[model samples]
Target: MELLAGARIALTPRPVERRHAALEVAMLGHCPGRVRLERLLQLPAALADMRAVGYGQAVDAFSSGAASELYNLPIPLQSSAEFHDIFPDALTATTEYVSLLAGNKAWLGLAVDDFFANGGEKLWVVRIPESAGQAGFLPADATQLHDITTLQGLACVLVIPALGVVGFPDLERLQIPPRLPDIPRVRLENFEPQFLPCTQNTEDDHRERRYSSELSDMPPPWQLPQVLRGMLQYVSSHRPDLQCLFTLPLAYSGELDSPVLDPTALSALSGYQQLPDRAQALRHVQFLFPYLRGPRFALHTPVGLIAGQQAAVARRDGPWRSMAAKPLNTDALPYPRLSIAQTLGLRDKPGISVLNYRNSFSGGAQLSLDDERLVVPALPVADYPVDRQRYDGFCSAEVMRFLGFLRRQLQALGEQLIFNLDYRDPRPRLLLEQFFRRLYSQGALRGASAEQAFSIRESTPQEGAMLYEIMLAPAFPIDRLFLTFANLNGEWRSEVVDG
Candidate 1:
């Protein structure tokens, strides 16, 4: 993970020994601090609630090396949702933040609520593992019909009629008949779940904007546009091989406050055609499109809830235009590796773009029917935030790390060679050339011949130093779309162009 430092050309080899691989990530959320000294002691209890709820694995990513550490901010706040307000300066100063970036063994996930309250802010994410959050209950028997209040603050759940429990949130809209038939149903509510006392108060305390349940203090909304820019800037500069993913809670206000009803959302859902400037959340997401440019992070949220909401709308107002299955910038947000390589006259390089992720089911809730019993499986508590695309990005980074190791090794080996102008002696230039040529022969370069893939030569010694110059045209993966049409018998036939 260490970069080549200083101008010295010789390479230093540190013996490779087995050690914990760095997955250094930090999770920042809110906890009552100095001003709320009374509440400080409750922090452990609150974290205990997080672990009990299913965020144990995610929190373990940071705490596994050491017990999960909690550093209090001097400033006191109502909730971590405002964590976005004290970002950058306040964020970077914390012990947890410092440790994450300073090559420590552990990583963290801090929940500063509603991060990205301001724009043009930046943040770095090391590696926060995903979690399958806490659960709510729904009983199997008809006698427990009136027990909905037991699971009050839950937003959604799986109705394991034979095994588990079911939860609440105005189930009147579901219309269970007088007899309450045992039929399977998938219900996603408009209410945001308020489970963590650290992030938000109980439902009885307030119905204020809420999103996903947090096992620890971390932002519910993933990739806050402004925040994503900051994370991208940090990661691209510090660790291009690593990537980040965001998870947004499915929260709803009044009918008008819902994302499904929002006109700009409607526009985006249609064809990504036009969006109003007023849609701040969607706009924040929109900003990362063809412009932000690299693939270091992916945004993961409960888009299925939004889609379901749209379906509800269709049942009521009739379908307008079909809704978009994903974001308009879905294709554009990934790094355009093929085009860039082509522009640079290099072969296409695959796996250079950021990943795109959509929840198969918002909250990862699914329903299945068993003979006589309507079985709703246990909600995927730890896996809801899981994303494999981000893993692919990590794999790509590991490759880069290996490449860096090889580069350093080559430099070191070359330092052992004699640099001379003698005709019979192989100069440093020849050694470097051999290295790159080997790379090409190993399928690292794109071309039918080494001559097409790269050019390396010994430039005239610069005043007093010898220099070897290399121009490499890396192979790129094909990623362009083209159509060809031919006129035959006064009819036009269209065909896709193959690479």
Candidate 2:
């Protein structure tokens, strides 16, 4: 743990300012250098250091609603002859490789690339002609997606993780992509938004790091191959012996949020009884999960849970993941992975999430504190992580909604929670962040001069602000739990906030 000696420090402005915020001078008197400092990064070499501590790659997350396509290497969604007409030359090359995967394979692959200090390769170049309102899209089943940047340059090859595939040109062939013309002069005016540099690692004092974990307690069966690939990336890039993800089950206090029950909810709970349709209730949900090497956890998704279908990522044989369960008690200290506070601090997220769990923070935070559940509302996007004791202004929408719901479900329950109208939109970082924030704000503007600090970057804006409202749910008990997750929507929204 590298301790900070003073209060303030200065560093250069990141080529990319908004997300990869490396302040010209950072205040670091209290926080240690080795802890939060590792959270920021200016170079790919940082990948090794992160792996050493405990970070993993997130791939193919877009279709799953977790990751987005913008960050993925460009790969065709389909390889059928029918789809080829719309594929770009690069995607065409990528498909050729995926086709080699034995099945009806698709992949992200690259043909020509080379970029270093003087220049970098174009990260994306999709030239699919527009059709009758349809995108040149492919399905998640596609096996391969080309990372053009990784294949084109020696710099990419030099900075690869230990295991996993990195397809560079057959160097013995003595061939490389043509470099862009020399730069005679430089000016801010020449910048084009689409042509912004890829968000790459930088050489800054404040490092920008990323962390990932399986969204659900169990891994989806369909995610096996991708899980294997991710595992390879983790095994090759990181030394998990020193650091890795610490996963609590669906019941663990780490992953879920906890809130007191309202009177109505208490009433409902007292007389709670199930009809016992095990098959229907268990339809597409998983019961257990296995930790496939890497940051992934395998799960047996039921068939009935997929978007349109009732069933989803079910293992071919039977059970999908390989995990058993045990209850979590106070003996468990900091979670297997970063705690909620640590996660918010590291990610620079203004608020926190509890996904769907509403009882994670039921335990007493203090040794002698009352057993009341702690609930706090999510913060606005602008607010950073702070000491819980110091936060009196923030409210936990999740808790209010949960307790409000229990008020109706459970009878005579007493649960108090605050709600906030403010929340920072977690639109996709690269593009969507700007788009939605722009839509909601009176006159938000991307600096006509704003550009990526690194070479590889993707920005995505969500439709929540435009199409629907999105809010964060951070619920802590007044005395017990600190953070919880649950979205008050549909009937719940009407019952909790609207009412």
Candidate 3:
């Protein structure tokens, strides 16, 4: 038997080819630059099948087990979390600064303005009734919402207008500048992927930092903040409940020394550890402590080992408060429709996967399970980085590859599996970057602009979002291939079959 992309089975229309072996989808989008279309062995057929899918989209949507209307949640209105799009995954907007600082303050004002001007839809998020960001800190009047009208006028006048001029309060226009500023705004946001520091090696972190600074365009200490959720705390015996978001360089280890923990970590794990590898350690603990469950997520760094570390301190602002640092349970969140119509808001999204026939488990779009329902696990290789930095040289990644056997098994079993491997957003610095010549980019974009709408977000429209970059953000490009565990006798066997 031979597997085909989209987990579909396409034998050699010949009689001898069908009896020899089967196919499966061992891995999907596992490799970058290249892909393992599928494997074949001792078969009479000359050709086999292949398939693929893309960003915010998956083969599950097209699978026979797919549901039609998974994302049909109840209607909602705007609220506080929407403004500044409170970055659940971003680093501190400002931190360790004796002050919000002149440069930082201006940047803040500019960011809010830009978010609205570009495709940023308003969720009308407001500051808490008693707020967290400002209160007696900046002049009460200075913290005015987006100066939309002024910016819009600045549009052709100050900047460009059609980029959909957006501003807070009531939207307005811009007041163009006279020949642009000498220092064109440079927002070096890195929001999509940063390696979570699993092994807090201070030296290693610094080395990474130095590496970045060497190539930085900001020049000197005028660097951008590191957008990370370090041990951020809110001391509130008297101040308005403050919610601070800060970022530091990936190289900054909380420890002053030991920037790189193990220079030979990849070459020799045990050998590298025992050779007097003394280094300082740093850790980041993120949580909503006393957590609330509307919509919350952190900017997960594409870290190899530093898994997600989070906990919550509930209602610390209100009367009672306590703290706990439990690991996050992703399953608890509502698993909305893992469908294309729902994900892209369009009908008939397609997927293709190659099922390797050789594997024992082959055929079917899904496999029924002993448990009441079959569930897919979270994406593997959680910290697989695929941004500009990670791909600088010959870095190895746990890329997607296809195994023919598993492909056929999924199809025959008729199981609906979830495939959620996020490859969106850059680090905060990159997200906020303005590496362009235009005064205003005409719209919100990370590297370049595109017409893609509907970003994957943690909360409401107000809170910051994991911008759904279009074709530019795919971890795996759209291919007409996929395979399933149709052959699996039960779900347990299916899960264990593939790593």
Candidate maximizing lDDT: 1
Name the regions of candidate 2 deviating beyond 4 angstroms: 1-88, 97-494, 497-499
Cα TM-score per model: 0.29, 0.16, 0.17
Candidate 3 regions exceeding 4 Å error are: 1-216, 219-319, 329-499
- Tens digits of per-residue lDDT, candidate 1, 359-470, equal 3455642211000100011111132123322222222222232233344445556556545344345556666677768767755566888888888766545555555666
Give the lDDT of residue 294 in candidate 2. 15
Q: Which rank order by lDDT, best down to worst?
A: 1, 2, 3
Candidate 3 achieves a global lDDT of 0.18
- Tens digits of per-residue lDDT, candidate 3, 1-499, equal 2449865974432222222111110100000011111211111122111111010121224233444221111101111122222222112333211110111111222333222232122111111111112221112222212332221111101111111111111010000111111111245565586676888653422121123223223312211111110111111111111111111111212343312111222122223213321100000111010111112221111110001110011111111111111222221221111233232211111111101111123442221100100011101222333231332111111011111111223233222222232333243223323221121232212243332311332322345433322121212211123434455566433222211
Better of 1 and 2 by lDDT: 1
Relative to the true structure, how large is the alpha-carbon lDDT of every model? 0.27, 0.21, 0.18
Residue lDDT tens for model 2, 1-499: 1224463553322232122111000000010011121222222333333333222342223223452222222221111121122222322221111110011111111111111110111111122211201112211223222332232121112122221112211110011011111112233353354543578643442321211221112211112222223322322223111101111121112223321111232222122212122111111111111111111111111100110010010111111111111111111122122344543332122222211111335663311100101122223223534344355323322132222222222221111111222223333233334433432232111222223211223233563232322232222223213343456663322222211
Regions of candidate 1 where Cα sits further than 4 Å from its true position: 1-225, 232-427, 460-464, 480-498
